[model samples]
Target: MGASARMRLQLQPPAIMAEVERLLAGRTRDIRLKGELRRLFQERSWPRTAKIIRAWMTWVIMLDALTLGLNAVLLPRAIALSMILPACILPPAALASAFVWTKPRAFWLQRLSITGGMFFILMSVALVGVGAGGEFYERHLNIMLFVATTAIIIFAVPLRWTLTVAAMALGLYLFFQLHNPRLETGSAVAATLFFASGIIATVVARRTMNILAQKTFLLELRDRSRVAELADANARLERLARTDPLTGIANRRWMMETLHRLWSDGMKGRDAAMLMCDIDDFKSLNDRLGHAEGDRCLVKVAGIIQSSVRRNRDHVARYGGEEFLVVLPGADEREAAHIAERIRQGVEAASLPNPASRVAPYVTLSIGVAAQAPDDAIASPEQLQHRADAALYLAKQAGRNRVVLHRPDPPGS
Candidate 1:
């Protein structure tokens, strides 16, 4: 119907507006049944609520005191202080204090408090007409003081609150001015000026808050984006560190770290086995296929070996260019040998296309298996890997593609 409403309707298509209306109707069902505003207020942060409570308390106590004091002292004798200007000072002071304690930060609170104190001092000037016999109705000092008070309110309170207070004060002042024109004209004019000033101040305050909220939101979004970027970088670094560049298996570093851990536990008498494997004729394969093909072949072999070991504690890793290692906790030499053989068979079964083969098969592996023993001389992870490597050499020498189990040297030897 209205221009703004028509603009909004154009922005939202008929279907979208229908959906929005449905959602609003659904939400309003709950609103229509609600009377829990007090409970909602109670849930506000404690310090914020405490500041608001202090404002109301200050208003009650200070306003009544100022009214009584004006009646008793300033209004009565019209002493050095003409009709108490505190009647105007009291409300502004209370409102100023409210602004102080409810300030967003401690720094602003101090600023507002100083403003309130200065306002009170300037308001005391209302006593200039003291000893001038004037009816309370004929008080120009109070009118001037009220104008100053409105200026104080514009600076002290936030926009919405300022507007509300100004509007209320203006309405009452206008009503009184209508009833008692001769007496209330000056004060009425002062009130109107303040009301206009309060409206402007309120607009400025709302604009400032909107700007601050926008900046804060953007800052939070930027921080979250930075965190997400850091997380992605860390994940990429971890993958690079742990994985083999050539074969895509866990690298030697991961293998050594795991074997070191297993060996340490073995020193405490925990059972674990290691299987060291080498691709037989791997040097020949490199000579036959280019380095690229060799790398692809190795990756394929690594996949086969990894699949052969199934236990939770079984770990397979790339030891070197054509070598791999496995750590099998709770496995003896025989069980480790069986796993090695299975891996060997799986590789042999691959039957890859080989143009340059001395033997008929494309690929095969030589595997050496060894188990940790508390009584063994292997005291460290290096010693464990050394023994497995030695066994692997023995397997390569014995035959191209067979599993070999490590046996301790004779005691005398």
Candidate 2:
């Protein structure tokens, strides 16, 4: 992207920005695109340029053959034979030069071939006209100018090359007519001035075309870069929306959505279990150590709980203040209790001291396990939460720093 991309306040790669700056500066000067942009522009245009150059060469060859036959038929034997000289020179030069353009070559060599081919072609046309004499002499100069103008308009080469072709054609015409026996000074000056005007116009037209093409290329790059940047920003925002900022784990909203999905799957939810975990005497710990240390404890506990689970199969969430929840799919009460016990041990092993706690001198966890079977009456994930919470209350009542299983109340009780 160029200047317009920079204004968007998005970052353009520094190296690419430098190239674009060079391009914009190049536009107003000699119309030669420089640096990395020049190389890329050449590579981009090469295929089409090759085809056009080859086609033009083929046509020039065919036209020269046709002209040789016509000269043999309509002109004197000596003059027709004299025209044979240019025909021999033109085809081989055109063919060799066209071959160079058809494949990739060094830019300097490419320009050299093209400029040399143009001058040879001009000279061959003038030689044919001189052999035929009279009106054909002036007409051949017009033909030379036509060839140069067409190259300027369609070749899509840089301005310097186009200017080179134009200058050579003008120089050839003025040189031949100035030394001519029949042509007058007044007519020669008028003809030269008129030819010079056409030359100037074609060169200016080619310059304008190059500037516009490079500008279009720059804008297209900027648009692609903006699209990539937008996609990355959207991904970061989505991650932030679903994650708990403090604990760096899944939040309550994500947990609820996942629960809804799991419950809706009748077969899958049948073998699911829920573990609701609360730190033993969390409020007392927070009161004694302040919220900063309490937040540190929460983060540490969340990490331990995550590490203890079955990875992708288990869903973990920071449900609310000092409370965490985990959902285990395809698990029974025994398996759920075992995982919950692991979580309890992992936290107690971390030696974060809570002075007010009656359980252990260090912090500890109490987890409640509730599971669903095929025949059980746990209709939704909320019912699982209520059961686990009930069990959690029992664990707190009996004493903290342990795991408890939720046993449903009997039907007749």
The lDDT leader among the candidates is 2
Task: Name model 1 segments beyond 4 Å from true.
Answer: 1-186, 195-199, 260-269, 355-360, 374-378
- Candidate 2 C-alpha lDDT tens digits along 226-289: 6767977998898788899999999999999899887776644678899999998888899999
Model 2 error, position 310 (Å) = 5.7
Worst 10 residues of 2 by lDDT: 1-10
The C-alpha TM-scores of every prediction are 0.57, 0.70
Clash list (residue pairs), candidate 1? 82-130, 159-202
Tens digit per residue, CA lDDT, model 1, 252-352: 88877776676565533256678899887777777888778788889899999988997566898998888899887777667777888999899889976
Off by over 4 Å in 2: 1-11, 14-105, 116-137, 175-189, 222-231, 254-276, 307-316, 325-342, 368-400, 403-413
Top TM-score prediction, candidate number:
2
Estimate the overall C-alpha local distance difference test score of candidate 2: 0.83
